[model samples]
Target: MPAAMTIDLSAIPADQRDAVAAVLRERDALKEINRRLEHLVAELNHAVHGKRSEKLSEDERQLSFEDLETAIAEVEESQDTQLSSKGKTRRPVRRNRGNLPKDLPRIEHVIEPASLECPHCQKMGGCGVMHKIGEDRTERLDIVPAQLRVIVTVRPKYACRACTDGVTQMPAPAHLIEGGLPTEGAIAHVLVSKYADHLPLHRQSQILARSGIDIHRGTLADWVGTAAFHLGPVVDRLAEHLKVSTKLFMDETTAPVLDPGRGKTKTGYLWALARDDRAWGGDDPPGVVFFYAPDRRGENAEKFLRGFDGVLQLDGYQGYNCLTRPSRKGGDPIRVAHCWAHARRKLKEVFDRDGSEIAAEGLRRIAEFYRVEANIRGTAPGQRLSARQARTVPLVAAFGEWLQEQRLRVSAKSRLGEKLAYIHRHWDGLQTFLHDGRVEIDSNSVENLIRPIALNRKNALFAGHDEGGRTWGRIASLIETAKTNVVEPFAYLKATLEAIAAGHPKSRIDELLPWNFTPSS
Candidate 1:
């Protein structure tokens, strides 16, 4: 133990000493946390830019930095949850822009009479001449020769006619890709098509070739790589921002990575951390961040969530057992709220395999819990808690009584017994929602967030390498976070790229966050 933790309570009276000792202990623990964080930051700096780290490629460094920031952000968020109280946060300032995206080129055509004579002159029995007063202009979106159109910027030079003088013209604007042909909108389109639409680069390349653009797959990959490099900071900031919430849903999925040595693909993992407070009427915008790792080790989770002490609503993955174990102070490190969907899925499997009455009754009882949840969603937290207490408490008690009764009758070695045992093992975690209505009946919120990952896996087959998986995770986090906030991914990403090209200040980085984003026309 550190000397700071060992305090002498001898000078104070017994009645007041315990309270003073408790506060001192908390203060010391916080100090220790701060020291560890500073040391961790120093180590990361050394590892990232150390003498022997020269072998890493630029793409690998980009991916690693994004993942490293995720871990840093999670630890910070966890610290915030445990140390601070909820406070009103100021929303980002909205930008005033037109509905139509600016800078698209326009072509003009006009119709005019051959002669300046009014046709009404003969009909009205009077001589009259047509004169131009004003013109009505109508604009319509038109696709030119190809689906993709080139935007040419012109700078008109002006100088004195009589005397020689230096010509003056506006300076060239910076682009997301410096000295490149693609627009920010074009790059954003490619990203949305690849990640959201799940059209792999080869197919997108083919599509572009047909459109007469002739961009190769490797070139498209380069564009994606550049976009990921710039957008990585936004994802890091997002992950850090999300961890500040009191509760979050977490889950992981397999990501296949190519292994050169084995000549076969290796298994990787993409972990998702989610926040959706709308169900309980919280004002914060919903978001999720995806993290890629080499494997699904519990240490990865611990590293990702080193300082988080908030409630985590997740599935029954044994990897999370590390969090439930007693900490140095002999108290639970984190609140592990188990998913009821997982518990019920076991019963459904047994019932599906064998027409068992026990499994049927379990499903029927769990259904009641969901039925109650459906009604209270989107209400106030207090209202949700009160309703759960009134309507669902009895249902839970009756279900518990019924479960214990069945556990005694069923054989220990039987298939039904095993399913019942699974539920019994996770009984405490399953009951977490009974006390707090802010949590859901299951971890389905995060489960829904990974649907796109599965679709992309089917389309792309596997990531090119482990670092590629990290790149995939970073880009997908922004796209998916945008969807949750009802923001269009392409426009949000385009505007984001435009800001980055214009040198958006790091201090105002939150303004680029999806929830704070205002869609461009």
Candidate 2:
């Protein structure tokens, strides 16, 4: 056993020094150990299982235009009967049915000045000839031609042929593609189709070629990559601005990456973070960000949160525990609050597997706390705190007591025991928010932020590689963050691209951040 180093209090002033400095150093060490234990318990209960199988990525069997048309036909057949019934029930009586015109007639009326008289009629008032005005009725399907129109720049020029005369010249107008094959609309269409609409480049090329555009898949790929490159710095600037926010939520989901070496794809995680008020307040919109990494390693989180500060609310991923620790270099450690929903979710999962009476009661009590939260969700922060204290603090206290009592009844090895342990382990951090008003009860804010990416993932399948995944992270960060702040994403993207093209300095690009961006009216 290692002996403890003692302090001599007799040499030091009684008010300035402790009599036993190293007496409980082991106790201090146990504090961190306990924190780790708590983190582990929470993580074990909330662990997600299984990735979507790669065999499920068949493009041919998935819903296509014909399948969609068939479905639409079925829906229309069902709706046609309802439509007939609706018309019979609500249609007004047609009073002029018999008098209605078969064809709108040419009722030509003639008039003349009072001074003029028709020679044939010999009238002093007016002279005119009645004639039928032709009319036609028809209907055609409205369709715009999908043809490319070339811009012609015919620069007509002349030069003087006299001695010591200067020559005149005309320059050609600039085109998006003087030598290339894509137009601005084509670029926007491809980007929106791929990233926003989730149609793959190969699929888009096939669709375009079918419509008479001789575009290749490789050309579309170049356009996408070039766009991402041009847009990269704008994303970085947006990310820098995202760091300055006070509250944050974080989560991750699987993103498949193609591996030609393995003759298949590999599973990767798309890690996302956000700051928003949706779960807590409907009035306050959210700013979101996403980052993709190959693994769920803690260093990835560290990299993601490098410049970020303030409260970071996350699920029960032990990787985030590293942020709570003191930095060896300097400054305050990033404060972390574990999500209550995450803690509750674990217990719910176990409850689903094996019905436990104790877990049931605990959940019922926790649900009451959420009920109180929901009631005051839209109120001001001070009022929310007051209501929480008045109504919710008692529930939390009673729930804590119930948890302590129930912890004894469950078996240590049983699933119920694991769930109880999870709730007990993070009890302090879980309740920490009751004291501070800024911390949220759950990571749902970030979860909501990442949902669009999840939807896109379902449709597009996965990123091609790690670099492609990073691009996903960068683009999602800007677009989603812009969404929270109510800034038009394309407008932001266009302006950002223009700035980058104009050689705007990177350090000063923070002014273009979504929250700070002032949009044109």
Could you say which candidate leads in lDDT?
Answer: 1
lDDT of 1 by residue, 1-521 (tens): 44654557897898999889777866766676677678668767966977434445444566577776777666666556546533423234334455545577877888887877777895788778988999987666666642677899898888888888788888889998999979999999999998999899999988888867788899988999999999999999998888777888899998898998899999999999889988888888899988999999876777666556678999888888887777412233889789899988888778877879999999999999999998888888888889889999899889888989999999979989988888888888888888886888899889889878877887888888988899899999999999999998988999999999999999999999999998655
* C-alpha-based local distance difference test score of model 2: 0.67
Roughly what TM-score does model 2 have, to 2 decimal places? 0.68
TM-score (all chains, Cα) for each model: 0.71, 0.68
Which window of 10 residues has the lowest lDDT sum in candidate 2?
48-57
Model 1 spans with C-alpha error above 4 angstroms:
1-146, 157-167, 327-332
Q: How accurate is candidate 1 locally (lDDT)?
A: 0.84
Q: Which residue runs does candidate 2 get wrong by more than 4 Å?
A: 1-179, 277-285, 327-331, 502-508, 515-521
Per-model root-mean-square deviation over C-alphas:
29.4, 26.7
Candidate 1 backbone overlaps, count: 3
Clash count for candidate 2 is 0
Clashes of each: 3, 0
